[model samples]
Target: MTIQVGDRLPEAKLQRIRDGVEVVDTPTLFEGKRVVLFAVPGAFTPTCSERHLPGFVEHFDEFRDKGVEVLCMSVNDPFVMKAWGESQHVPDGLMMLADGNGDFSRALGLEMDASGYGMGKRSKRFSLYAEDGVVKQLNVEAPGEFRVSSAEHILSQLP
Candidate 1:
């Protein structure tokens, strides 16, 4: 089943490249923190690069002002995600997380089959507001839709 608004996110490790590649355990990352996590189907895709990530980057300050940690996750490996971040000029406050094996997305029931597009198991576009690891609000887009998961939309839903 897909994760719901009241569910606590599962404990799974996602990767990021700061100094070098490192694993960030999901539960610990969100524990005792206000977080806004958004996922895209893949990194460097047209919509993802142009609208999805930029929306979050543009609204990052508003999220932080509300004490929310913003995160962008994709099914790509840490290397691609890191490179995409550098290309997009993503800010320090927005975390770029790599769900390399789709374990985290699978655990959350958010993994999608993108084999038709030559991408394997990827995540659907979605955004959620979680506090202390428990989801307070979730906006999961229908495949190919992009409205509700944007940072602007999430910011309007913030508590």
Candidate 2:
């Protein structure tokens, strides 16, 4: 089932490039923290690279000032995610995470088949606000659309 408001995020492990690919569990990452977790279909894709990720990087401080940690996830390896973050000049605080196997995406019911685009199984473009591990809001963009999941939109929806 798709995760909904009031639903606690499923337990899973995610990878980030810090300290040579550190692995973090969902509970530890979200525990007692207000977070904006946004997923892109794949790293380095046109819209994801040019707009989606950049929006979060630009507005990262706004979210931090509000005590929200911004996380960017993609169905790519940690190396690609790290390179993309570096290419985009992503700020220190915004996290670049990898759901390489789409396990986390599948667990959230946000995995989508992108084989038609030569990208196998991937994550849908979406953003969710979670506090202390429970979801408070979700914005999922339609296929080939980029509106609701943008940082400006997610920032505006903060409680």
Candidate 3:
């Protein structure tokens, strides 16, 4: 089953690129924080690039003002994640994370089979609000839908 509110995130290695690629364990990222974590199917795909990511970038300050860290994750490599963030010009505020081998996505039961699309194992689109490692709210989008997981939606739900 997919993870839910009150569940602590499972342990898995996730990557972020700074001066160099850095690997951070899931617990370290979630511990002692309120995080707005969103996942996309792929980095450069149309909806992901055009709509999904920009939503977070546009409202990042609001999340920060509420003391929530914003994380954008995909199954791509750290290099690609970093490049994408830089291309969007918000590398400083958004935490672009890579799940490299889909270990974290599988553990969360949010892995998607896109072999027919030739994308192989990828993450489904979703977003969650986690506080100190335990989820407080989660929005898992229906396939090909972007309605409930947008930044505005999360912002509206924040306390």
Candidate 4:
């Protein structure tokens, strides 16, 4: 089943790049925080590189002031995620997490088959708001659509 508002977030290990190295499990990062977690299909894909990530980067301070820790996830490995985060100059408030084996994506029921694009299985574009590990809200886009999960949309839903 798809994750929904009010559900406790699934517990899954994620690889985060810390000090230029890949670190594992790291779920404690969100244990006592209000987090806005958004996922994209891949690291450097057109929409993700130009639009999706920049939206979060540009709104980093606003999210922080609103007590939301922003996290971006993708199916890429930790090295790719690290490179992409550095390339984008991601702000400290924003975390770039690697769902390398798609365990987290699959757990959220957000995995998509993109084999035709040669990308194999990947994540659908989506965003969620969590408070101390329980989901507060969720915004999921229809396939090929981008309107619902943008920063603006998420901001509008913030209390």
Candidate 5:
């Protein structure tokens, strides 16, 4: 079963590019915080690059102002995530996390098989709001759909 609302997020390794350096096993990055984490299939794909990620990047300040930290995750490597963030002009507060091996995505039961597209395994499109490591809400999009997990949807549901 997929991860559900109110479940504590499972601890897993995460790869991130910090200050031009590669780092790993950064699950504690969200510990003791209220966080909104969204996962996409890949870094430079059409819908994700054009719409999904931009929505989060655009609304990042509002989320932060509401005392929530926002993170964007994908199955791509940290270098791709960092380059994508830079090319997209992502702001400072929005963190781009890499689930390179899909360990974290699998832990959440959100891994997708994109082998048909030659992308191998990747993450499904989804979003979660967590408080101190426990999930408060989760929005999982249907395959190839993008409506439920957008930034606007999450913001509208926020208290």
Candidate 6:
């Protein structure tokens, strides 16, 4: 089922380039934190690289000032995610996560099929705010749309 407001995030493992591709768990990351986790179909893609990730990178301190952790996820390997973060000049506190097999995305029922573009399974363009592991807000964009889920939009919706 699609995760919704008030629903606890599912248990899943995600990879991050921390000292060499460390595996992180959902509970460990969100158990006692206010987190904003955003997903893109693929890392380094047009809108994702140009607008989406940059928005977060640019306003990262604003979110941290409010005591919220920011995470960026994509359906690519850890290496790609690491490279993208480096190329984008992402700040240290902003995490770049790799859902390599789309396992976490599938668990949340947010996985999208991108075979037409030869990308295989990917996560839809979306963002969610969670506190103590329970979703507080979710902003999922419609296919090929970017109306919501931007860093600015999510910042405006913070509790």
CA RMSD of each candidate after superposition? 0.6, 0.6, 0.8, 1.3, 1.2, 0.6
lDDT at residue 59 of model 5 (Cα atoms):
89
CA lDDT, candidate 5, residue 71: 90
Show where candidate 5 strays beyond 4 Å.
22-27
For each candidate, give its TM-score against the true structure.
0.98, 0.99, 0.97, 0.95, 0.95, 0.99
Question: Cα deviation of 101 in candidate 4 (Å)?
Answer: 0.4
Q: Write the per-residue lDDT of candidate 2 for residues 34-131, one digit (tens) a residue.
A: 99999999898999999999999888989999999999999999999999999999999899999999999999999999999899999999999999
Candidate 1 achieves a global lDDT of: 0.94
Give candidate 3's whole-model lDDT: 0.92
lDDT of 6 by residue, 28-145 (tens): 9899999999999999899999999999999999999999999999999999999999999999989999999999999999999999999999999999999999999999999999
Q: What lDDT tens digits, residue by residue, belong to model 3 across residues 16-128?
A: 98779899998889999899999999998999999999999899899999999999999999999988888877647689999999999999999999899999999999999
Deviating ranges (above 4 Å) for candidate 3: none
List ranges where model 4 is wrong by over 4 Å: 20-26
| Model 6 poorest ten-residue lDDT run | 14-23
How high is the lDDT of residue 130 in model 3?
93
In candidate 3, list every pair of residues with a backbone clash.
none
On the 0 to 100 scale, the lDDT of residue 6 in model 4 is: 86
Using TM-score as the yardstick, the better of models 4 and 5 is 5
TM-score of 4: 0.95
TM-score computed on alpha carbons, candidate 5: 0.95
